[model samples]
Target: MADNEQDHEHTPLLQDQDNNDNEQHNHHDQTSHRNVVENIRNLIENEIPNGHHLNSSSTPKRVHALLPRLFTLINSLVDCSNVEDEVVTDEVVEYLCSLGQEVVYGLLRCIESMVAEGQRDVGRKRLLDRRAEITQVAAAAVTKAFVDKDRMGTYCHVLSRPYYAVGEERNTAENAIEIAIRVHATDFIADIEVQRCVQALWTGLILQVEEDESRIRFVEYGGLRRSRRGLLDWFDIGRLNVPKYQNNMKIALFIFFLAMYTFVVNNQSPNPNIIEWLMYVFVCGYIFEEFRLIFEGGTAFFLGSIWHWVNIISYSMFMVSFSFRFTASYILTDKSKIVQYNDIAYDLQALLAVFLWVKTLSLLDGNQYFGTMVMVLQKMLKDGIMFFWLLAWVFIGFLQSFFALQKAETKDFNAAFSLLVRGFLQDPDWELAEVLDNKYGFWVFALYLFLTSIILLNLLIALFNSSYTNITDSSEKEYLALFTFKVFSYLKSPDQFPYAAPFNLIEVFFVIPFTPILSKENYKSLNRVVMGILFWIPVLTIAYGEQKRYEELTGTNDDDDIQGGRRRYRHLTLDDISVEDLFMIEDVDENAAAVSGETAIQIANGEEGAVVDASFTGWKSNGPVNETFADFQRRRVKENEARAKAAAAAARAEEASSSSDEDERADAAAAAAAVASSTSAGPAMSEALVQTLLASIARMEERQKEMETLLKQLNVPTAED
Candidate 1:
């Protein structure tokens, strides 16, 4: 009935086309739709043959008349949108089956006529017979497309919402899920609300039926999304972010032993038996670990516990032992261990171990106390009582070897006194020549003590005293100064190489204090100190040598002159220059103006109150030289306020831009869709054809309703109570 209505409305257009064709050709085209229809009617009246090949022009109009009827049938099969009742939805699905193969094949033929050869296979009727299966696939594709669209919508929502714009928390997950449920329900699920509730019930039922263990381990529909690779796999060797170079205990211990040997050689002390023993022990430990790895393959527990701890123990032992002996010897001998090339070498080893311990402690975070304790020990070894012991050893070694030796040999007190008197009274050739000789340095031991007490003693005292001061303050500046001194000292004599070898376990005992502080939260502040110390040591060592060379060249003998020489050379000093002079000398104002001229000018004029741009203009400002307390405070306050305002403005602008983008996106999304009807006009209908198509659709729906009513009546029982 709907097709008949559409055919009646479109017949005039076919008649007009036939007339036009006839006028152009100057002949009546019987192949035209009007001509063909008339001819077919005439043939029926006159009893003519039935096998007539209709031309393309006439067939299309005839097909057009049949298309609306066929479109209604196909549309019903997969039309689940806005369905509120299951009975009606079922009736629609059942009514679609009544079309049978004949109508389906005809529809396929029409589609084939319009579509290209590549699409003809897809237009086949074999799959259309199982129209339900085809509908399911189409629904899945449509659902996936809608889900992607919904995700985009949610992203826009979160980006555009006023709360999000103002820095309130964004609702990303909630928005995504809400959109997914809404678009799918209205477009795909028949009796949408009821079907969705049923799906939820089915899911809950399945979950309840599952065993506890299975449920726990099963792929949950709802859970935090994780990468396919398990957590442990990421930590495996050769994976992402693993430590590239391991701190080898064997190499560190060798370096430690080398340092000890150098220390003994430089100080001209007792047997280096301790250093030899350390080397032997470290080699043994390495051999043992190598054998274990060879036989058992490496395990995590072994690596983390036994291997790492053993190295720490060895390093701590070396440091503690060295500290005890060196401190005692320096005190007794009255020699400056700080000046010795070998002592520097040994400390370098300890320093490396300390640095390694610091790094490991960082990995453990704040939870590990053992690592922190080790760091404290390292500090004590580096800057604590070692200098006192070194002083004691320097003084005591001379007394024990010389005065005590003479006292023991001299049975007469007068002879002992005379022996001491003879030492100074002796000729320069007799005393100096003997002291310079290989074996008679027993007398010269007194000279070593005297010179050390006066010269080397002060240096040792200053070195340790300054280190202690820095350790107490633990400031970046102090650490830098200490490191600078160490570097200068080392460069003055390269034989005292820092960390020349790998580290040992015992030295790590002194590195534990750093573990608690080397966390990511604390590292930024602490790292500056550590890096300053590390870099400053080398630089200061060079500076110290240069200063010493300058003093030597200038022939300076005053202790104050020596101290002044040690300081870094600069063109200007605070007391010697004014704010304006400093500005002139360094061209500070010019540089600041070049970087940000407007901001610099405002700051200089004090008109804009030092307002800075968002990109760190305030932070980069050059304030008054040697600024007074009030001036510094005022400048700082103004700069901070300007920076804060700039940052706030930038944040507001970013939010505004984001909201505008979202508004544009939402507009585009709204424009993309047209007003949808209870039933679509199918893929074959267009706006130019809407009025004729709607008349067809309305009649088809009425016919479907009548059929459903008739079918229900037929199915009803005839027997009554």
Candidate 2:
């Protein structure tokens, strides 16, 4: 009993010793890991961004080694064993963010260096050489990086290529921009250099998308052929695509042009003159562009936002109006019919004009006030959907009762709808009360007014007010998200070389039809020739302005000493922010409302050709997913816990089964021998039985002692209750 007490006392000491060894091992591992992280971080900071290492030359060996290594390090830091062990402390995550930041800085610096050659002469015009010249230098490096890295299609999305898993798949790719976005390196993204590159990159991608989308697959032209690269050379790329002249400037100009065209060529009177004919052709192409979005995004995606519905309704109105105007002038014979069509057409065109101008707000994302408000309004509109739903049900109930209770022989659904709408708009008709002489219909109307105008309307106001407050409180973060979306929107656009609307007319008629018939070289040259011919002046203007702006920003213009762009060495306070908060939209978890970085709560899915997510290797994702980082983490934690429990249970079951089988086999053998000895007969049997009994007894004693020893080893009490 005293020995048992001593053994029990010694057990805790042994456990402490084992635990101490494990702790030491863990400490050693942690120290080693920290050293590795520090070394990688140092290497990234020291080597990747250094001007000497960033070789635009043939032998950029250091860059080649370091860039790949830098990405590898980011991948490791994001997903290594520590992540699974739940030991991914805040420090490590922060350290990981720093490494990602450094990589972004390096890319930005590399671009700045490459483009720096263009601004050497202290002016926009002169550069080291033509290839090394101002506009060309910027285009070549920035464009090539985005264009060549085909897999880097949508870098701004959270669930972009290399799906960020908790333990296994969450790692960055060769695309530097993608890693920067994943790590939420906002300051890095916000930098002038990185912004320019990203802008140009998306521009290049847009150009590619347009080239592909524009192609006609006629069997005559061997069906659905696309050019290799839409913007063939530096000169051919859209001037508006570059920041020099500003794409927004180009978009605003195009809208203004569209508005003017519509007003001037008002075919409401069925007057198809030369200008009207040209306007008709131009609008046809514009309509095509808008309508094609339906096929690409599908019905659910179209219903995702208010803007999408507006696009569908406005364009549909225009098409119908055009159809009526054309039929009235050309197809219809009767004067009365013509007059009726003209009246409807006029009304529709007038409505379309309003929508067209209002849609300019969509492009106003460049300005902080307009852009942020646009986001808020879009959110509120979506929120109001539920309010509108309840209002509809109540209105319908009132309508049925009011119509049923009406003693009048004639009842108009349209009049009923108008009355309800007016009531909601604060112009309720008490005429029903007077006419009905306080009947059931009058009472129903009063109830409708109370429910809809008083109760439902106020509820909606509170909802929008709450939504407005939530959005505006984080206005800065929201704006940043919008800006990221601005960059991302460019990439999402299907048009590879997105010419502003009126200009897209040229591509639709001229470039697309000939693409499949023409050879790759010829097709490319044709696109180049067309873009240059149409936009050389603008392109040249952009180049000059960019170099001029470049000169001004760098202080290269102020003094002979050129104040070239500098590297970001230390992190600014703003740099250290939660990536999830700043960039990623909240997970919507539903397919319809999920898309883009609209906090938007634009958060889903499968594009047919593209098999995206972790398994995909393509540039575009298969489709949008409705998960965010937080959603993924919760799901992954649950899965890991389930798997762990399942594994542990299986192991214990196997261990117990093996132990029970061995014990049962040993006891069966003992029982068989005892039975055989007891059945022995006569003198010989008696002598053998005595011997067998003695042996069996001895064996039983040994077995009992062994069982006690085994129980002690297993921490099972030897004496049981």
- The global C-alpha lDDT for each of the candidates, from Candidate 1 onward, is 0.34, 0.46
Q: What tens digits encode model 2's per-residue C-alpha lDDT throughout 1-721?
A: 3443333333322233433434456776555433433322322232343111121211123233334433333334334222332333443332222222122333333333434544564553232222222212222233223322321222321122112112322111213443344333343455433453344343332122223424211001000011111222122344354332345545755565576557654643455566656666666666676655555434443454466677778768877987888898899999999989878877887777777777778777678888779878988887788888887788888777666655677656666767778888888888854454345656767787888878888898899999889778867656665565455433334443455566777887878899879998788677767776777776665545534433333333334442365543322443352222112111112122433433222111211111121111112111113333344345445434433443343343334334434455345434443443343122222222223333333344446668878988899875541
Off by over 4 Å in 1: 1-226, 229-236, 244-368, 384-386, 393-721
User: In model 1, what is the error at residue 422, expressed in angstroms?
Assistant: 29
Candidate 1's residue-wise lDDT over 413-450, tens digit each?
44333433444244123443233333654446457635
Q: Candidate 1, residue 420: CA error in Å?
A: 19
- CA lDDT, candidate 1, residue 202: 25
TM-score of 2: 0.51
Worst ten in a row by lDDT for model 2: 216-225
